[model samples]
Target: MTPQRRVTLADIAAACGLSKATVSMVLRDNPQVHPNTRARVRAELDRQGYVYHRGAASLRRAGAVNAVALVVNDLANPFFAEFAAGVDAALAEAGHVLLLGSTGESVERQHAVLASLVEHDPAALILSPAEHSSAARLRRVLGARLPVLLFNRRLDGDGPGDWDYLALDNRAGARLATEHLLARGHRAIAFFGGHRDSSSCSERREGYRDALAAAGITPDPAWLIECAPTRQEAARQTPALFVRDPAPTAAVCYNDAVALGLMAGLAACGRRAGADFAVVGFDDIAESAFATPALTTIATEPRARGLQAARLVLARLRGELPASPHTTIAPVALQVRASTAAAPDSPLQSSVQARGPAA
Candidate 1:
């Protein structure tokens, strides 16, 4: 038995007794085609089992497709999940689909994901780069064609390139968290979690240090604890903050995950979080609000940030923006909760007392 011949547009047009051009226009939903003619074309198409070759159509139309690529470091993290959800919501409203890729914080994995996504001819790319990612390396994989919007992490040699960037106000947010702790009379505060090499972590640490210096209190060298920005690692490393002579009374955590982990670790060590040790965290993930004693955090609003990132890409794609690269630093706000309090016998108590009840 031989395979049947595949039905073509010409076959459909012949059956409908209409010109191939007219049938093609109807198939594409072109406004030029009459409603009655479109109905007839559709009837003929259905009768002949005509399958629309979207890939072929996209190729013929110069690679125009309703899809965009979004690559992030860790999707399992609720922060990125919320961000991706926001991106998806915006894209869906704009009649576009999001092609997602998770790099798991590996530069090599990012290369592979981008290579695969490019084959699908995505209209644009939104990338949350892994730590130590370089501009030259990204350029090699992405080529010079597709528009890329960098999210959160910036490339090492980014310079003034023709790419858009959307990032949280990491330094300012961390400063807000640190300052909140200071306001509650915490002087010997530790900067907790996140690797020192990461750009976000580095900025957060700078903010922590800045807040301490502004209070005329130098942070102890041993108090700058470095760990993976993960709950498990933070929990394991929490004990180190209390190893030294002058133990820290508070901690400015890298993110909510670290803060929550530290809280759990404190429990294991027979120390209560809000009462015994004041804690403040950056990126108020959903779990932050429901944690034991609730978390005092800087809310970056990951989901809303994701929506803005998508809109930025859409604007660029529609040529609504200038040719020059754009950068947007989203603002953050502090959410004071039960997780912070004045230190026991704190030196700053005098300053708080002088300011009266408002302080």
Candidate 2:
């Protein structure tokens, strides 16, 4: 027995009693086609098990790709998850498909993912790059034609490529959180979570240092604690904050996850957040509001940033963006809650007055 031939636009057209172009227009979902005609063609196409190969169709057209590619460092993180959701929502509204990939913060995996995505011929790419992603490496993998929007992290090293940048105001956000703690009379404050080498972490650290400097308080070198940005790592590294004499009364966490984790760690260490210790986190992820004692956080509006990222890449594809490398630094806001408070014995101090010994 011979295999059946694949369905084509001509076959659908003949079956629908319409011209091939009309069937093609219906397949493309072009509004120019009459609704009645489009409905009839769609019905016949579905009945015949027709598959419209988007890649092939895009190839037939001039300067077109069927999908927008989004590569995020870690989808498990709530902030990035929300950001990716916003990207998908905006792309869907614009009638484009989203091709998604994850890197898990591994640069080697990022190279592989980008190389594979390149084969699909995406119109543009939005990447929340993995740790230590380099400009030269990305340029070699992506070639010069692909329009890219770098989210959150900058590429490693100088002479940054011409990719567009959408970044959170890391420094200002950290400063805001630190200042909030300072206003509550906490003198020794720690900047916790994330490796210092990461650009976002470095910027936030600078902000924390800046806030301390402005208050005529220099941050202790020991007070700047480093860990993986994840909750587990932050929790595991909590003991480091108390190793020095006159431990921090407050902490500016890298993000909400780290803050929530530190809160749990504080409890295990017999310290109560919002009481003996104050905590402030960045990236106001949804869980921050509901965490035990509720977290004080900086709101970076991750989902909205994701939407902005999609818009930026789409603009690049449409030739609406400048030829020069452009950066959009999103603003942040401080959200105060139960997790942060004044020093234990200070005037206008936190409601719970018990302090962990030796801190």
TM-score of structure candidate 2 = 0.91
Candidate 1: minimum summed lDDT over ten consecutive residues — where? 349-358
Among residues 3 or more apart in sequence or in different chains, the pairs in candidate 1 whose N, CA or C atoms overlap within 3 Å are none
Which lDDT tens digits does candidate 2 get at residues 1-359? 85999888889999989998898888778999998998899999999999887766777894656599999988898999999999998999988889999999999999999999988888889998998988898989999888889999888883655779999999999999998888777899999999888899999999999999999998889998989988888888898999988888899999888998898889889988888799999999988889878888899999999889998888887889888988999999988778876786677663453222112
- In order, candidate lDDTs are 0.88, 0.87
lDDT string, candidate 1, 99-134, tens digits: 999999889998999999998989999999988898
lDDT of 2: 0.87
Model 2: residue 250 alpha-carbon error in angstroms:
0.7
Candidate 1 local lDDT, residue 228: 86
Q: How do the predictions measure up, each by TM-score?
A: 0.91, 0.91
